[model samples]
Target chain A: METLTTPLLIRGRGVVSGRVEGEALVTTQTISGWGGINERDGSIIERRHELVGQSFAGKILVFPGAKGSSGWSAFFHMTRINGVAPAAMLFTRMTTKMALGAVVTRVPAMTDFDADVFTEIRTGDHVVVDADAGTVEVTRR
Target chain B: MHLTDTEKAMRDGAGGEAVAAAMDLLIRYGNALGAERLVETDNVAGAFNASTPSVRKIAENGMAEVFSRLNLDSDKTVEIPQMAARTCQLITGIDDQNWALQGADPQMVQMQRDSEAFVGQRGVNLMATCTPYQVGNVPTFGEHCAWMESSAVIYCNGALGGRTNVEGKESTGAAALTGRIPYWGYHLTENRYGNRHIRVEVPVRSMLDWGLLGYFTGEMVEENIPVLEGQMSGVDLVKLKHFGAAAASSGGVEMYHIPGHTPEARIADEAFGPNRAEDFHVYDAAARKKMYDTLQSAEDRKVDFIMLGCPHNSIEQVGRIAHLLDGKRLHPDVALWVHTPRAIRTVAERSGYVARIEAAGGKVMSDTCPAISRRLPEGVRVIATDSAKQAHYLPAIAKVQGWFGSLEACIEAGLTGTWKGDF
Candidate 1:
C-alpha cells in the first residue's frame, strides 16, 4: 500500500498448498507461539521480541522459524479458530513445531527457499503466495 | 508420505470416523514435514485434558467435540475411540488439588474432572505432570515415542536415548489414535548425533550450575544437539530433568550428550559417531555469570510468589524443600507452591513431607505449574523460582517480573518477602 516495484519471483518447497495475497510481515527472528503471541488477535506478546505488540492477522507472515514450547501448533491452531491467522506463511527453518503449525493453520506456506526471503522481502510488501506452485511473488512497497 | 495398507485403510475410514480423521491429519502432517513414511509407536505423551479456557466452549459440546476439533484437527465431531497406543497426559491448566488457591472457577474445575473421566475411560493414563518419566513412563533406550512437551522431548532423547521429535497437540493426538507418527527428525538414529560441543571450564556440580550451563548451551545451539564435556558430574534424575527443561525453554534444544553418562553415548566419540562437532564453545565462569544475569528479569525487590518444581520436581526436590522450610513460615505476603507429580506427592504425603511444607506456609501441589495452568496467587506481580525453565518462561507467559536463582535463594526470598539473591 506504499510503493510499487517489479514483481520478484522466488521458489521453495510448498508444504501446505493454497493461494493468497496480502501485505507481508517479516521477522528474521524465530517466533514463539505459546508465549509469543496472543491468539485472540495474533499480536506478538513476548516482551523482548522485536515485533512486540504488532498483530500478524491477515498478513503474509515471513519469519525464520518457530521456537519455544510444543504448544506451537496448538496456539497457531487457535489463531485460525479465532479468525486471526496469517494469510500465508514463509519460513526458512524446518522443525516439527513449524511444520505441524503450518499444516494446522491451513494457510499457504512454503519453506527451504532458493534465496534468503528475509533479504528479498520486507514487511508491508505485497506478497502473492501460490503454495501449490511452490512460488512467492513479492512486490516491494 | 508413504503409508502402508493399514494406514491407508485407517485414512479411508476402516477404523471409523474419528480414527479416519486422525489418520488424515497424520498424512497431512507427515506430508507437510516431507516425511518418508509413518513409523509405529507404542508410547505417546500428549496434551489431552480440556481444562483451559480456550477449550471450555468446545468441551461444552462434549469431550468428543474438543478432541475432534483440538486434538484431531477435524471439524467433524465423532465419538472418540480408545487410544491405539499407550498414552498419557501432559501438564494441564488446572491443578485439581489446589484450584481454589489458584483462583480457578469451580465450574471449570468440574469440567476438568469430566474431561479427565472421558479420556481415562479411553485408556489414557492420567499422568498429569510434565515429567511422565518420573511417574513410571521411563522410556527404554532406543524406544520410539510420539510425545509433546519440549522438556520431556529433550529428556527422552538426551537422557534416555528414546527417539522422538517434539510433537505437538494435534499430531500427538492423532498419533495416540493411530499408534503412528511420521518417521523423521529424531526418530531415525542417524539424526541423533551431537552437532554442537560445549566444553565446560567450571565445576558444574550443583543443580544451579547444571541449570545455568544448560541455559547457555541451549541459547548457543538452539534446536540442535549439544555435547557436554568437562567437569560434568553428579547427574541424576532431578538434575537431568532441570537441565533439559532449562535448555528446552531458553532455546529449543531437544537433545544433548554427556559422553559416558548418557545411554547412547558411552564416550565422547560415541556421542558424535559418524559425525563431527560443527562448532566448539566454552561455558566458563563468565559464561555462567552471564546466564545467571540473563535469567534475572525482575527489577523489583519485593517478591510476591515463589514456584518450585518446574517440569514437576522429583521426590528428592520435594523433600529438600520440606527440610529447608521445616520451622520457618513464609512472609504473610508471599505464596509458595512446590510442584511434584500426584504419585510422588502421595509418596511425599506418606513420608510427611507435605505436612512439613504446609506447616512452613507452603503448599505441595500436583498435576500443574503456574506456566501450564497460567494461574497464580492473586496479586502476584513479582515471582522467584528455583527452576531456570520457569524463570525463562513465567515472565513472558504471565506478564510478571521473575527472578532466577538456586533453591536456597528462592526460599530465602520467600521467607523474607524480598529479593536479596546471591548468584
Candidate 2:
C-alpha cells in the first residue's frame, strides 16, 4: 500500500482545533437531511442509516456533503447544546448547511480535499484531521 | 475571496448586527467551499423554522434580545416571500383547542410571535410553505440565492439549475437580512454537475411513485448529487417539488440533476461541467419498486390520522383538496387535517374553500403541520397523507404506519378510514 503524506490539504482561517486525536466515523451518507438529527441528543435518526444510533460526539466525521434541508445546521446546533457534536468534519464538497453546522457546532472542519481521500477513507478509521493546516491524516487501527 | 464593497462593508461590521452575523456565516461558508469572495444577490429566498419555547427563550432573551437592545432592526430586510412553519403544537399544547389559548410553553409562543413579527416587520411576505418556488421566490438558472428549504435547494440546484446551498435557517435569515450568500456548493458553477449517474427503469406513473423514486434515489445517492437519467420523463414544478422534498428529507442532497428536466442537464454531459465521472449502473425497476413497497404500509389497516400539506400546502393545492372532497364526509374515527399558511387560509376562507373542506369533516388548519407542529393530536395512528414530504416525516412523528399518495386518494382514505388501495 502506498503511504501518502496528505490526501489533500485545505486551508481556511475559520478552522479551530478543540480536543484532538479521535476516531474517524466516515459516512458516504452525510448526516440527516431534515430533522433526523436530534440536537437535544446527538443521535442519528435516519432509521435506515448505517450509522443509526451512532453519536458524532468527539468523532472526526468524514462525509461527502450536507444533504436534505437547510435545517441541517440547526440539528447540529442542538447537538452542540447537548455536548455531543463532532470534534471535526472533513467534506468532499462543502454545502451551506454543512458549513453552517460547522459554525454552530463550533468544530474544526476542512473541506475540498482531493478526490482520493473520499475513496480511501473508511468509517472507524483512526485519523488525525488538523483544521489549522486543513490536512486529514488517516491510519488504519 | 472577493467581496463587493457593500459585502466587504457588511463583513467588516459597517453593516450592523444582522448583516455582520450574516457576513460571518457567508464568509465561513465561502471559505468552506473554497469560494474566493462574496457575490451580490439582490433577491434572496429563505425558509426558517419557528423555534420551540425553550429554544426561542434562548434565541429571544439570549440572542434576539441582543439585536433589539442594539436597535438593529431597521436595516434588516427579507427579500423572500415566505417561510416554513415548524410544529405549532410546541407553541400550542396538545390539549389546547385554540392555539393562542393553548398552554404551549410561553417561551415558545413568544418565540413564534417574535419570529413572525420579525418576518412581518422585514416584509418577508410569509407564504408559510416548504416550496417557496410555488409561491414566488423562483430563482432562475445560475442565480445566486440563500434558501432554507432542503428540497427547494435540490430543486433549484437540480431542476432549475439555480444556485443555492441547503443553507441553515440562521444563514438563510442572515442572507435575507443582507441579501448575500457565500458562493459555494450549488452556488459554484463547477459543483452543479452530477457526480453519480442514476437511471430509472421503473415506470413512475403517479406523483406517489415519483416521490418514491425520489426517496430511493436519495438513498442510493446518499449525500452526493446525482445526474438522474433513464426512461423517466416529464417532471413539473409540482412533481419536482414533492420529489425534491422527499429526496432532501431522505437524503441530505441540496441539488440533483434530472437529465431532461433540469436546465443544466438538458443534455447529459452538460451537467457534469468538465470533470465527468464514469458511468454508474442504472437502478432497475425492481429496485424502484422495492423502494415504493418499503414506503407503503405493509399492514392493510385503516388510517386514523389523515394529514395534508407537508412543506405546507399552497392555496391552489388546498383548493384542489377542497374541490375533491366537495360534499363527502371524513370517517368519524379519522382526524382529517389540511395545513396551509394563515394567509392562504384567509384566501381559502374568502373563496369558500375552507367551508367546503370543513363541511367534509376535514379541518383546514393553518400555522402548523405534522412535522413541525409541536405535537400530533394524541392517539393518532396509521397516519396517511398525500404529500411525500409529510409521509416521509410522519412515520417518525406518528411513530406508526404512514401512507402517502395523491390528494384524491388521501381524501378517499380519510372518508373510508382505510388506506388499502393502490393509491
Candidate 3:
C-alpha cells in the first residue's frame, strides 16, 4: 500500500474555530437510533464510549453509520434546541438518523465517503473536510 | 433502491398524505444508507423524552398550540391495548420548574407537544415510552417492526426474534403512520444472524443484571448482531427490555440473541444461521459483575431524586409499587417519580393504587421518564433507581453518584428520601 500522509480531504466551514485539527473520530460505532447524543451538551452519552466526555462541537466526526431508535434524530434536534451542536460530520454512510440530525443542526456534513475511509482515518488525527463538494481533505498532521 | 409498484404508488400519493410523506422520508432514508429496497413493517414502537413535568407540559402545551393552529382532529387512531394518551396528562399538577432542569428544549418540546397533541386529538395510539415492547407492541417472530429504542431494537431482533432496525424516531413515526420502512439495514434477512459470539460463564440473575450484561456486550461488540449462549431461561421480557435499552445505550446493536429465549436462537448454532461461529468472547461471572459495577458508584448518601421506570412502567409494576407503598408517604426531601403509560395509570387510579402511592407522597407519571428529558431535581448530587437503564443514563447528563438496587429498595429509598447504595 502506498504510504498516504494527508489521509482524508474533507471540506466544510469552520463552524467553531480553534485551528485545532485532529485525525478524525472514525467510529464503526453508529450514533444512537435514540437519545445517544446530548444536543444540549453536545456530548456522546451512549455509555460505552471511549470518548465519553468528547464533544462533537468541533471535530471531524465520522461514523460507519447511524443506528438505533427513531429518537436518534431528536437528540441532535434537542442539541440544536439547546444551541449545542456539532461543527461538522462525515458519514461513512448515512442513515435516516444522521440525515435528520443534519437537517436539524444544519451543520456542514458529507456522507458516501469511501468505505476504505474507515481504515484510513483514526480518531484525533489531522484532516480537513468540505461538505459542499463532498470531499474530505486529509493529511496526517 | 428499487421501489415496488405498491411502494411507488404510495410515494405517488396513493397511500394518503401520511403514507406519501412516510414514503418520501423512507426513500430519503434509504438513499442515505445506500439501501436497495424498502420493507414493510406491521408495527412500530416509539420512545421519546418524557422525564419531567415541564417537558411533559411543553409537550402537551406545544401539542395543544399546534392542534389549534393546524385545525387537525387529534382523534384518528385506533385504540389498542398500548395506545393511551392520558399518560402525558399525569404531570398536570406537578411543579413545572422540576421539568426545566430535565433538559427540556422549548422548540422540540413544543414540537413534541404539538405532535403528541395532534396524535392524541386524532385518537392516535399514545405509546410514548422508549420501550414500546413492554406496552404490547409485540411483533410475532419474523414479523417486521420499526422501533425507536436502540435496546428494544436489539431485543426485538435478538430475543423476540422479530425483524426490525434501530430506526430513528422520525423514521419510525413515518413508518408507523404509513406502515413502511426502508428494508435496508438490520431488517434484512442477511443481517439477521449473528456475526459475533458471546460465550457466557456468568450468573446473569435479574433484569438489572441482564441489563448490565447487555451494556457489557454492547461495549464488546461493534455493529455486529450478537448471539449470546448463556443463562437463557433466566431471561424474561422485562429483563430483555432493560437489556435492549442498556445495549443500545452502551453500543450499536440492532439485534441480539439469548440461545433458548429468542426465537431465532433455539441453540447457539442456530443464531449464527449458516455461518460458522469464529469470532467469540468468553464472559464469566466476575466479568458480568464488573460490568454492573462500572455503571454504579459505591458512595451511599441521600438522593434528592429517585426515578423508577426507564422503558415506562408496566401496570403490574406500578401496581406493585402502589401496593408496596400503601399508606406510606414519600419523604418531603425526596422527589419520587414513577414513569408509566396513561392507561396503566388509569388502571392504577381505578384500582386505588395511584392514590395509595400518591398519598404516600410519590407520583405516577406517564409519557416521560427521567432518561430523555434529563429532568432531575436540582441540588441533587446523588441519584438512585431500580432501573439499570436510568442508573446508567442519568450520570451522563449530570455529575451524580449513580446507585442501582431492587424495586423494593428503590421504593424504600423514595419513602425515606435516602439513596444509600446498600439495598
Candidate 4:
C-alpha cells in the first residue's frame, strides 16, 4: 500500500454542491439501488455484489456508479428520509440513475476526476469532498 | 446544463407552480448528469403509486403531495397538472383483487386506488403493468422516450429500437409535465452502437436458454451494449422479453443487438458501425452451465410457491402456461401466482386461459408482482419461477430460496411441492 504523509488535492467536476468530510467506503464494483440495496438501513443486499451485507450509511461512498432498476433514485431517496444516507459520493461514471440518486440523496457528489480515483483513494482513507469547489482532499494512511 | 429560452421560461414559472417545480427538478438532474440540454419526449412511463409504507406519511396530505414530494422531488406541494406527454404508469404494488393473498394493508391498498383515481384522471394511462410495450404504448423506432422499469427500458431499446435512458420517478414526473428529459446517454445516436462482441458457441433457442445467455452476457458486459453473433432458431417476443429482463437485472444493460433479430442491426459488422468493435467474448457450454447454477439461489429442494410471468406475461405465454396446468392441481403445501397485464388478462378471461389456470390452483393476478410489492404468499421459504429476472431478485428481496427453470419445470415443482431438478 502507498503511504502519504500529507493530504492530496484532486480536482474534478462537481455534480452536487456541498462540503462534507468522512472516511471513505471504496468499492471497485458498481452499486444497484433498487433490488441491490435495503434502503431502510442503507445496506447492500445484492447477493453477488462485492459490498453485500455492508452498509454505506454515514460514509463517503466511492464506487463506479449506480446500476439495476430505475427505482434507483427512489430507494436512495428513502435513505435520506430514514437518516442513513451517505455523507458524500465520489463516482467515476455517470448514468441517469446515479445523477438522480445523488441529486435526491442530497449529498456532496463529484465525478470526472483528473486521475483514477480508485487508486488515489482507498477504503478507510480520510477524505473531504468539497463539491462546491470541485475538489477532493485525500490523506492516505 | 444549457436550458433553452422556453425551458428557462418554464423554470421562471411560466406554465404553473407544478410545471415550474418540474423544470427545477429536471434542471438540477440535468446538471448532475452534465447534459447539454433537455430532449423532447412525448412518451413517458414512470412509477407513481403510493403504496409503500415510506410514502404513507406523504400520502396523508393528498396524492398531490405524494407527486410533488416523491415523484418530482419537490418540497413544495404543488397541484400537478394533466400530463403534457402521453404518459403511463409502470408496475405498481398491490394487486387490485389479490391484496388479501399478498397480505397488504387495506389502507395501503386504498392509497394505491386513490392514487390511481388521481393520476388516471390526469391523462396518465394506467397500463398498470411493467411491460407497457405489451399493452398499447409501443414506441416507434428511433423515437425518444422517458421510461422507468429496467425490463421495459431494455425491451424498448434492444427489441424495438426506441431510445431511452433508464429513467426514474422524479425525472419521469418532470418529463410528463414538461415533455422533456436529459439529452444524454442512450438518447444520443452515437451512444446506441455496440462496443462489445459476444459469440454464442452453443444453441440459445428456448426461453430458458435465451435467459441464460442474457444473464451471462450482462455479467460479462455490465452497462455496455453487446452485438451477439451466432445462429439461433425460433426467436420471438416472449424469448426476447425474457432475455432483456434477465440482462437488465443481472447488470445495467439497456440495449443489445441480436443481428437479424433486433431492429438496429442486420449483421454483426453493422452492429458496431464503421469503426467495428474488436473486443471478443465467447459463451460456451461451461459458461451456460455456470449461469444456470448461479440463478438457482435455493439450496433446499422443498418448494412452497411458484411465480410466473415476470415482465408481465404476453397472451401467448399465458396460453402456454394454461396448457401446462390443464387437468392438474397444485400441491396442498404449494401456492402459485401468474401475473399479466389487466388488458391481456381481460383477453385471457374471454379465451378461458384464466379459468384453466385457476382450475390448477394458480391465481391470475394483474397490476403487480411479489418483487415490486415486496409481498409474497404467507410463509413461503422456497419458491420456483420461470423468469431468470425474478429468480435473481426474489432471493434477495424476499429472503426465499429461489429456483430458476423453464415454465414446465416451474409448473412441475408447484404440482409436487418440491423441486425435482428434472429440467
Best by the TM-score measure: 1
Write model 4 residue lDDT over A1-141, tens digit each, in one string.
Answer: 757577889999999999999999999999988788999999999998888999999999999999888999999999998999999999998999999999999999999999888998999998999998999999885
The collision pairs in model 1 are none
lDDT of 3 by residue, B57-124 (tens): 33454443322211111122212122211121212112232345454556555555555555566445
DockQ of 4: 0.89
Shift of residue A100 alpha carbon in model 4, Å: 1.2
RMSD values, in order shown: 1.0, 5.8, 6.8, 1.5
Clashes found in each candidate (C-alpha, N, C closer than 3 A): 0, 22, 58, 0
> What's the true lDDT of residue B231 in model 2?
65
What is the lDDT for B254 in model 1?
Answer: 94
By DockQ, rank the candidates, best first.
Answer: 4, 1, 2, 3
Misplaced by over 4 Å in model 1 are A1-4
Write candidate 1's Cα lDDT for B60-93 as tens digits: 8999999999999998998999999999999888
Candidate 4 CAPRI classification by DockQ: high
Candidate number with greatest DockQ? 4
* Tens digit of per-residue lDDT, candidate 4, span B290-367: 999989998899999999999899999999989999989999899999999999999999999999999999999999
TM-score of 2: 0.81
Candidate 3 residues lying further than 4 Å off, grouped into runs, are A1-36, A40-55, A63-69, A77-87, A91-135, B9-21, B47-114, B121-123, B297-300, B326-332, B415-417, B420-423
lDDT of 4 at A35: 83
lDDT of 2 by residue, B203-280 (tens): 765667677778877777766777777766557766777777777776666677776677877777876768675557
lDDT of each: 0.92, 0.64, 0.62, 0.92
Displacement of residue B256 (Cα, Å) in model 4 is 0.9
